[model samples]
Target: MQKFQELSQTELESLYHDLLGKYKNFQEKKLKLDMSRGKPAADQFEISMGILDEVNSKSSCLASDGMDCRNYGDFDGIPECKAIFCDMLEVDPEEIFIFGNSSLSIMYDAIGKMMLHGVRPGAKPWSRCEKRKFLCPVPGYDRHFSITECFGFEMIPIEMTPDGPDMDTVERLVASDPDIKGIWCVPKYSNPQGITYSDETVRRFAQMKTAADDFIIMWDNAYAIHDLYPDQKVPLLNILEECKKAGDPTRVMIFASTSKISFAGAGIGVFACAEEMMARMKKLLAFQTIGFDKLNMLRHARFFKNYEGLLKHMEKHAELLRPKFKTVLDAFHSQLDGKGIADWIEPLGGYFISLNVMDQCAKRVVQLCKEAGVILTAAGASFPLGKDPRDRNIRIAPTYPTIEELQQAVSLLCIVIQLAAAEKLLQISPEK
Candidate 1:
């Protein structure tokens, strides 16, 4: 196939008409497919069904430290449960706080707490600050941006390279601006793009100078152990330890969860920071609730047992996920490769494949896909304010749909991409 850019006007029109015919045929099928979010498929959930049976009405419901799992104490989390997260996050038990289900909720509360009460006792509340800002890496997670946006912080876009966010810009901005309170980081297997932060990026983050005494790095390790290739797993430096080593024990707040590993709505969430910081957050958390679901935590502890158990379970997830991702990538290679219309990353782990279609065409490609009965994440959802400056990047989530569904959806996606690219080169309206 000729590259869309090199094709003559007549050739481009002919190609566009052929793609349009295929697109109309798809529209006739009345498909109800969705690829909007990184949700675990039904089959992936089946592998973790044993967790429900791990704790039952007949179970003792007692934690390892003799605390009743049915009771309200242990706001930080039960001992055995904390031990599992400690191993997973490479932090001490005292440095971790376990919450229910969503790490996103824990993150929201962390920000809200700072806004209402301030970062520490003597510190002024963030709401009172003349200016509040957060650093957001481009083509990043939407929810992360939403959290800071909800708190009324002005979000600054940071360029993301394969290694990670542009640290030169991150260091320079945070150093000069006392208003830049925090930066959102998906350090390992980051959302959408799946680019892990290099060791130097992590080191710089830990050792960088910040003008704000209460500055923070929101290190969200949502895909810490979500490896598609077991033998070739990617390594991430532990930022919490690095911060402590830098004599800035309070500079980082790390979060992780088993939402994907087990039941998405019923799994455990954890927060890790300095022991003193943990103590301070606990005081604020006490007003939120008596405790999170301890019974659920106990069930997870007994089911996974340790970090190795979690890894083994993720291997099963990879078994189910690897093929779905392949279906998308394979379709892209066969149909879209060398077409000069699109580009994509082959992620080793994480839930999304980032596809960059021709500039000024992603929104049209997505609209065409939706018109053909396939749904996708909004074109600019990966960026802050849901606006992609180039209007080219689209996050493809292949995890929720079945392999058969993915095969159809990706094929349609490629076709729409080609049609959109051809339309752009020919300067024709989509209706034409």
Candidate 2:
């Protein structure tokens, strides 16, 4: 196929005319859809209908450990639940600590606690210090950015390559800058882009020597089990294990949850870290609450016997999610396959399709879709402080929509792309 740059003016004009005619036909369809957030569909949640049976009116409120789940007492969460999440997160049961319903809240608390009363891990509290910066990778989770944004930390946005974040830049920014307190990472099936960190990237992360002892790697493995392709899900190098191999187990804070596995707003969150880190984390947790919901923890523990059981259940999840992913993927390639106006990656697994339009056209593309009644993730959501440097990347979530809805929605999305790209290209053409 000829490259867009090599195309003659006549060829370009002809191509534009064809796409414009296609876009006009799309306007007649007048589809209404949303590809905004990575939410599980109602059918997916049916798998957890058994949760109602995990505990019942006839069931005992007593936990396996002897703690009454009815009342608060387990300051660190029920041990059984920690064991279950330990398997879910692929860490030692002893290394895992179950938290509240939402991991995002716990993440905020961790940073907030440090702000108010320095990191009690024998480091300077952030309140008294002036230099506190965070490393943020572009095309990342927006909510993750929101968490860092709240603290007023200087966010350094790193460009995300196919393999992962630019590690050379990461090494320099992390090692040389003492002010670089932390870096947010979603290594496995990363948000938006759905690109997993390679083993080499993990090795680089493990070998990183931060200037600050308290420097943390907030690893939010949110979509670890939401693999759309069960067989092809790229397993992470286990940051905790890798850290130990590098003699830095305390550096990475591993966060995972059943948010997508079970229910979105009601699932449990876990934080797996080295013992030393946990001690500091618990020190901060002491002021928050005496304990989290142990009953919910017990329910999850009994529902998933161990790691194998959890993996088996995730397979069922993939069955429901596969069609949704294929619907959008097929539509994108079908309509935009040879178009030089845009490009995207075919992710092996995960809940999103990251589409990149021609330079500086993300906002226009999204607006075009919205006008046709399909909402998308915000235009610049994939960058630090919500500003994509290229202004072209867009994240498409296919999980919540049904297969039919996804097909129609993706079709409309193709219209948005074609219209936006044509207008932008025409502006640069000599014919304009």
Candidate 3:
């Protein structure tokens, strides 16, 4: 259990050879295991199956406001659905807008709208500008970066602290640069790292003055109700409310979804902003579709009657996910603990576990894992532009695989880490 760096050159060489031999053995076995994306396992998806029958032939198709669920034209969202999300997101019903299945789709549309027409109601559209930039919190979500990149915005990487993004840097950057149009935030149970923003961080974000009149804070609270421990849930300050209190009502856009709660692709997505901002987005959204899937919204409203029902459903998810997270963490502790080869965060509730390998060795470790029959989220995937500056972070998604498969995958991954680290040391050691 000694730290690898503390060992002698001879000891390091022997340990490296041992790990290499184990890697070869695993490769020979031809194991086909994947830990790539944070997808719900089959059993986790099954618990929400009852919602499938919630709006069947015997059910009422009318929304609370008497709009027929089977019909069109409730573009904002059915009242019942908005009511549910309002309670969950802690926003007014007028401020929330419902979209079809994916929140990512909503985000894409929001960025596109900004590109074409401006983020704020009357500001110049981003497309008309010569330069545009987005502040990306590092060790952050890949898809968020991809979205900004697609729009040709320069992604400025901001370092993430345990509390949140380095706010001092963010404040300075936004204050000095008018072209820095927005920032992507997972605020609660953030992707990869699961670190929630501190209340002070939230307040700073709410009160900070940006150079750009149209600057936006994209708050994607995907795991708002996704707590692994029901009794130990972390609460986030309602950013919209905070912004309103700070007199910057339109500064933040909030999003959430039931994708993890009910079904992956079949669930509903929610978008909430200040009333004026929501009005602007709705005008843009009207061009896209006459209406979203209201029937699906109705189905959700009936299935989960209120926030309490949503919480109860998530508890079921936690029951399934907690074990998988524990298994991964336990394996990491057993094989890599005290070795000084890597570091990681133990998330209370989130889809991924962020593992930090030695600088310059993450790619090698992932490649080694693949060669040994395990798949991982690509090395450096947690940062802007898919480049981890230190070449370290590796995102671990344990929810998709069973405990037994995870056991094999995690075991091999640890050996691969040691091997990669050992090789890295050899390259630098004077003894060589």
Candidate 4:
């Protein structure tokens, strides 16, 4: 039960050997387990199978505004679809633009549009900025970092506290640097770590002054309704409303999708901002396509009739996800709790569990797990350009595997972690 740091060189060596033996045993089992990405298991998909029947050929294809969904021309999306997001995200119908299955695609297009045409018609395009920069919170979403990297933006790493990104740093950097044009935020049940932004953090983001007039807050509220505990839901302050109150109605572009709720490949994505910004985006979108899939939007609208219905559907997801999360946490508690080598977060509603192993040992642990036939997200993947400066953080995604497979995988993972940590400590021990 002693902490790894409390053990002497001989004791550490012994512990290391024991863990090595266990790891080799796991290798002999030839397990094929993957925890690399936060994908929903097959059983979770079954919960939303009824959505396929929500919109069949026999069903009326008419939207709430009497526009036939089977045809093109509903550019901003059908009224019923917009209304669902308006209620869910607490924005007006005018502010919401429903899109295809992926919110990530919408985000990429948004950035690309700003790069080519600037935030408005006459403003200087971000691509022309002398030194374009973006604020990326550390241990953040990799895809968010990848987007900024793709645009050739200088990604500044902002340390994330339990409340949110360090606001003092965010405020100071943003207010002083004209080149700092935007920030990526996952305010509720944040990716990897489930830390929700405090009300104060949200307010600071809203009221903070930026040197760039076109400063943007890419508020990707992907997990806004993905609560593992339905009765004890975490509230995220509406960034759009907060910006409006701060007299910056167009400061943020909010995004969400029903990818996880209904069907990952067929669900609807939404983007919301001020009415003026919506007009600009729609103008640009006109060149791209006449419309997204209205039938899919209509299907989602009919499936989850309202925000309340959406919540009920997410509760079902929570039911399936809860055990997966619990299994990983329980294993950590039983096997790695008192070990000084690792620490992790117990998230309420996010798809990932963030684990920090001993400094400089994360890659080794991942390598060991891989050798033992277990796959994990690369050690530094959560950071910009795939580099975790401390080299400690690891993202654990448990939702994709069956409970039995997860049990075997996590057991091997813990042994590998202990082995890696022990190896690191032994290398530094004076008695060695």
Candidate 5:
């Protein structure tokens, strides 16, 4: 609930006084806590240890195709593993290609390949473009930004509407600007903000008529299977199906992984695109290695057993996760609601929360918390080039810490915000 607009000056003073007291107490406690990074908490990892036993040396390591799992041959991935990843993406088996552990690594490799050889989702090698540009929706995944920047592409900032990137800007820039090469999107439970792209956003993305025929859309579906609330799962229109419906199978390259559901580093990665794109990708990937370890693929497939198994594992994650989520949310609500000093999103399932304080105070607020023994993701990391244009967004990761640690951390955060905001206001006030 929010207050109505007409409060007397005395009333404002009383409110600020209460807020100040709360801030001072948080400062006095001086607790050292961290809830900054999105890596899973130790407990979240423990429950999935059975994945290690899913396969063993004594087990029959043979695949459904009669190929030995221990040996390497299927560069694109074993058929069963591809099918599991495909079901997660809601795509056909032919559209999927499984890779090594990290999807981030796969994504990085794609960019590297593009820069050296310039393949844009299997289109004409973008090596032809003298000046390449990429579209980034603000408050986006910093790693994605870093990937594009590493290739020396210009990162153009686009506003993130609640639905998705402002398509009006996206369509115009991509349509008229040949230099604009691609856009990075986390369509489901997007990294820091956890927003799912609306159907219209998906349709518009599929329908973009780019000036550069080689323009690509990099769609990361990292949280496609990570749901905090099973019944409340966020629905995203399948990009593969959407593109096919629009009759443009070549428009996107989709990426996904089993990092959260199982042992992250040991889990499998996946990428899927149209038949044409896959053919082109095969050409590029063939240069790297002759064959990938199909045993791990076999392991993940045997571990999950099927799509239903993946869903079951994700539910166990939710059980461990829900309490941690509640601690942070409850702390924020109990301590700072309507304080006029900060605002944060209560994401339904993602690993991070986007916090907005007064513009320009984010850096100092984060610094203050660090001094008080709480570590946070570096300020300005939610946008391109480690910069939040408004200087107000702070990403809080609650999943990696215990509830007690997160509780203490959120308490410290509330204090840091208040003191920093008050100092800022006082420095600017003329009547003080």
Candidate 6:
């Protein structure tokens, strides 16, 4: 349990030799494991197989309001699906708009809309602006950064505190600039770190002022109902309500999907915002398609009769995912705890464990793991523009692998961490 820095040169050198030997043993095993993405395991999917049976040829593909789902019409969303989201997202049904299977796709379209048209009616389109920028919290989702990057928006990396993004800086930056148009947020069970925004943070987000009238908060609440521990669920204050109370109702746009709950590609994605924004969103979306897959939406609504049913279904998912998370965390404690080489957050509900290795060691550790047959999310992937300024954070995804497989991967991962740390230490030590 001693910190690596506390060891003497002689002890460090000996430890380095031991770690090198462990690394070689891993090399000999030639294991091929991938811990790159936070994908649900096969066992998790098995419990939700009944969803596919929701709409069969014998079943009536009709919405509760008697709109036939097999045909077209519900462009915004069927009332049934929106009502489900209203309960899940803690917003009114009128505030929600359902989209295709991927929330990421909806996000992309939203950004595209902002670039092509303004955020809302009568505002200037971002394309006409001389400069455009987006705030991206560090160790954040790469896909969110990618959407901004693709549109050539200047991405300003914001430091993430345990509570949330550094709001003092966010407030200052937004107050001073009209060019800073938006911020990408994953409020509950955030992508890589799994830190939910504190209530104060959400309130500040709602009340923060910007020079630009069109300033928006892209709230991707992907894990709103994804509780690993069903009994001790964390509650998130609805940002839409906060914004409305703050008299900035048009400031936040919420996104969510059931990709992890049921099926990845076949799930329903929903978009929620103020009434003004939703109206603009609907008008823009009408130009793109006649309507989304209402049958899929009906299937989801039927499978999970109410919000309670969705939560109950997620319990089965938790049964499969909990062990995998524990296996990795237990391995970290057993093998790397108090070593001074790495640190990580124990997430409550999200799919990843954010591990921070010594500066300059993450890339080396990832390379060493890959060479030893374990694939990991690339170093610096959690940051904007694929660059982690410190090059220290690594996202650990445990849900996709079985417990045994996860144990093996974590075992090798620990070895690589030690090997990389020792190598870096030895290079700097005067005794070398």
Q: Model 2: per-residue lDDT, tens digit, 1-432? A: 454556677876787788667766767777778888888899988998787588777788777779888898877778777777776677776677888788888778778877887664556888667878999998888888888888888899998898889999999888888888888998878888888999999988989888877788888888787666766778777788888999988788888888887778788888888887788788777877788888788888788866677788889988988878888778877777887867888777777888899899998888877877788999999887889888999998888988888887888788778767766766654233
Candidate 3 vs candidate 6: the lDDT winner is 3
lDDT, candidates in the order shown: 0.92, 0.81, 0.91, 0.91, 0.81, 0.90
- For model 5, the stretches where C-alpha displacement exceeds 4 angstroms are 1-30, 120-124, 428-432
lDDT of 5: 0.81
Worst 10 residues of 1 by lDDT: 1-10
How well does candidate 1 score on lDDT at residue 366? 90
Candidate 3 residue-wise lDDT, 131-154, digit = tens? 999999988999999999999999
Instruction: Residues 265-311, candidate 5: write the lDDT tens digits.
Output: 77888999998888878888998887776888887888888898889
Off by over 4 Å in 4: 428-432
- By TM-score, the better pick of 2 and 4 is 4
lDDT of 4 at 236: 86
TM-score of structure candidate 2: 0.94
Off by over 4 Å in 6: 428-432
- Candidate 3's displacement at residue 342, Å, is 0.4
What TM-score would each prediction reach against the true structure? 0.98, 0.94, 0.98, 0.98, 0.93, 0.98
Q: Report the error of model 1 at residue 123, Å.
A: 1.4
For lDDT, candidate 1 versus 2, the one ahead is 1
For model 4, what is the C-alpha lDDT against the true structure? 0.91
lDDT preference between candidates 1 and 6, better one: 1
